[model samples]
Target: MIPTNLVVHQQSKVLELTYENGSTYCLPFELLRVLSPSAEVQGHGPGQETLQTGKRDVLITSLEPVGHYALKPTFSDGHDSGLFTWDYLYKLCENQEQLWLTHLEKLAAAGLDRDAPMTKQGHSCGSH
Candidate 1:
């Protein structure tokens, strides 16, 4: 299903996507950043997932179209690696609520906050 409209609610940091199939999805800025399909996040091969950190207050600065099937999101942190494909964005939107809840749960389990202090190297420490 092709998205008919993609709206970014800057105040709420949510992306509202409406598809031609009558489905509407709302995804958070943080979720999209962490779950980016870019090689930087997903890595170059399997078993190489890189956990993103310090993205609690991150926001989407811009959303640019990549040809006809994807969006190139420019994040506030200058990250533009993820090319959010229509299908992938739809999936994230569809699973937004659950995914966010799970993310929160994982954060809680690890005793981490989104705004937690960064280490000296400017990166967050691994999950405890």
Candidate 2:
């Protein structure tokens, strides 16, 4: 179920994945960024998931391979921890519509705008 081709369409802001079966999925950069599997986003346990907002314009600045099993994408917002595995990517392709709907619902429930800028969190100091 591994993709045979991966094309980054900067103009369209999507990552198009083509599999051997000829099925293709065009995943939006914003979706990838918001739904990233990084601990910063997903958190360390259940009920700790962070709702991502203001990511409608996010981009994939770079994509690097992680061995033969996954991909690591550096996002325009400086988030690069998510590791997208082949199986996980395939699932994303299959469930994108539902996932997007859910994201939108969460945003609405939280009274957040998808196009608004994300407020900086944590310390005021620049030190990480």
Candidate 3:
């Protein structure tokens, strides 16, 4: 379903999408940034996907349409390569919970945090 409306809630740091199917999805800015479909994040092939960390405070700077198919979101971190198509947005909405849990699990296993990276001494090095 195509989104009928979109709102960027800066205060809440979420991008809300209202679809024609009456489904409203509120995706966090950080989630969108980390899960970006950009080659920088997804890489060029399978198993080359990069795990994103220290993105808890990241925010969307802007969003522009790419034809009628997708949105290109500019992030504060200077990443703007992702093309979030309607189908991909819907998929993210449907799998948000599971995906978020999976991300958290991966972060934990890697000794990382959403807000910062772990150092060799087990302390937060910084947001990277």
Candidate 4:
């Protein structure tokens, strides 16, 4: 389902989406950045996904519509490859809690802090 309205609340750091069915989801900027669907984050194959860290302060610098199906967001962290499709976004809204929990679990398993900076090797830097 497509969103009827989308509002970016800079103060709250959330992207609020309102659907035709009157359902609204407030997605945090951090969540959106860490969970980006871009290949840079998701990788091109299974087990190659890059775990994101230090995104608690990431911001949506700009957002643009992509054709009639998706949105392209340029994050303050310089991530702009993820094209958030309508269906994908709806799913994110529906499954936010579970997805977030899973992400946390993965981070814990990797012994990485959500607010820790990533190193050049795409892993969290313990020095920081």
Candidate 5:
């Protein structure tokens, strides 16, 4: 399930992943950052997940491989904790559109904007 090739296009702000199955996925840096499977973003458990905002322009600065199963992407915003596992990455590619829409819904439900920072009184902001 590991990607055969992982290309980070900084200028385009996207990550192009090619799998062994000959499938390719073009994932935007923003999307990856927002949906990062890190404790910072996903929190420690269900219902504690944090919604990431204002990441529409984020970019991956570097991608370092972790063993032979995952990648650690350091984003321009300084977020590098999320380790994208092979299977996890494949899941992201498989459910791209639906996940995006769900994220959008979460944003709207919180009266937040994809292009705006989460600055409401008690909300945890992801701005860096």
Candidate 6:
């Protein structure tokens, strides 16, 4: 199904999308970054998922359509591997609030912070 409406609010860094099926989704830039579908994040196969850190401030710099069904989202941090398909994007949008809460919970449980700094040694330096 095609998206009937796609509104990108640059100021708020939110993408509000509405599908032809009457489903609406609101996706935040930061959420898209942390949940990127790239192999770097999702891994090459099952059970290799990598949780992203220090992405709380990540922002969407641009959004380009890859085709009728997906978008290549450019991030301010120079990450652009994820090709967000319409269906997948819709799911993210729909689950935005709950997913964000879950992300925060996971971070806390792991003794990590989304905005933590990375040291020169390539390790995150902050309260965990």
Best-matching candidate per TM-score: 4
- Residue 60 in model 3: lDDT: 86
Identify the runs in model 2 with alpha carbons over 4 angstroms from their true place. 122-127
Question: lDDT winner among the candidates?
Answer: 4
The CA lDDT at 43 in model 6 is 67
Worst 10 residues of 5 by lDDT: 119-128
How do the residues 28-117 of candidate 2 rate in per-residue lDDT, one tens digit apiece?
999999889887777777866778887887889999999999999999888898999999889899999999999899889889888877
Summarize candidate 4's per-residue lDDT along 1-128 as a digit string, tens digits: 99999999988999999999889999998888888998888877789889999999888999999999999999998889899999989989999999999999999999999999976654333421
Pick out the ten consecutive residues of candidate 2 with the lowest summed lDDT.
119-128
Report the Cα RMSD per candidate: 4.7, 2.5, 5.4, 4.4, 3.1, 5.3
For residues 1-128, could you state the per-residue lDDT of candidate 3 as single tens digits? Answer: 67899999988999999987788999998888888998777876886666788777778898999998999999987888799998998888889988899888877887777778523322132423
Off by over 4 Å in 5: 120-128
What TM-score against the true fold does each predicted structure earn? Answer: 0.79, 0.91, 0.87, 0.93, 0.90, 0.79
TM-score of model 5 (CA atoms): 0.90
* Candidate 4 clashes between residue pairs 3 or more apart in a chain or in different chains: none
The local distance difference test score of each candidate is 0.79, 0.88, 0.83, 0.90, 0.87, 0.77
Which 10-residue window in model 1 sums to the lowest lDDT?
Answer: 119-128
Expressed as tens digits, the lDDT of each residue in 2-36 for candidate 5 is: 78888888888889999888999999899999999
| TM-score: model 1 vs. ground truth | 0.79
As for lDDT, the candidate ahead, 3 or 5, is 5
- Residue-by-residue lDDT tens digits, candidate 1, 16-112: 8888888877787889988899877776688565556688778899899999989999999878979998888877877778877876776677677
Task: Write the residue-wise lDDT of candidate 6 on 1-128 in tens digits.
Answer: 45788887778877788877888777878788888888766766785655678776677788899968799888888878899997788778778888888878877987878887533332232312
Q: For model 4, what is the error of residue 82's alpha carbon versus the real structure, in angstroms, after optimal superposition?
A: 0.7
Worst 10 residues of 3 by lDDT: 118-127
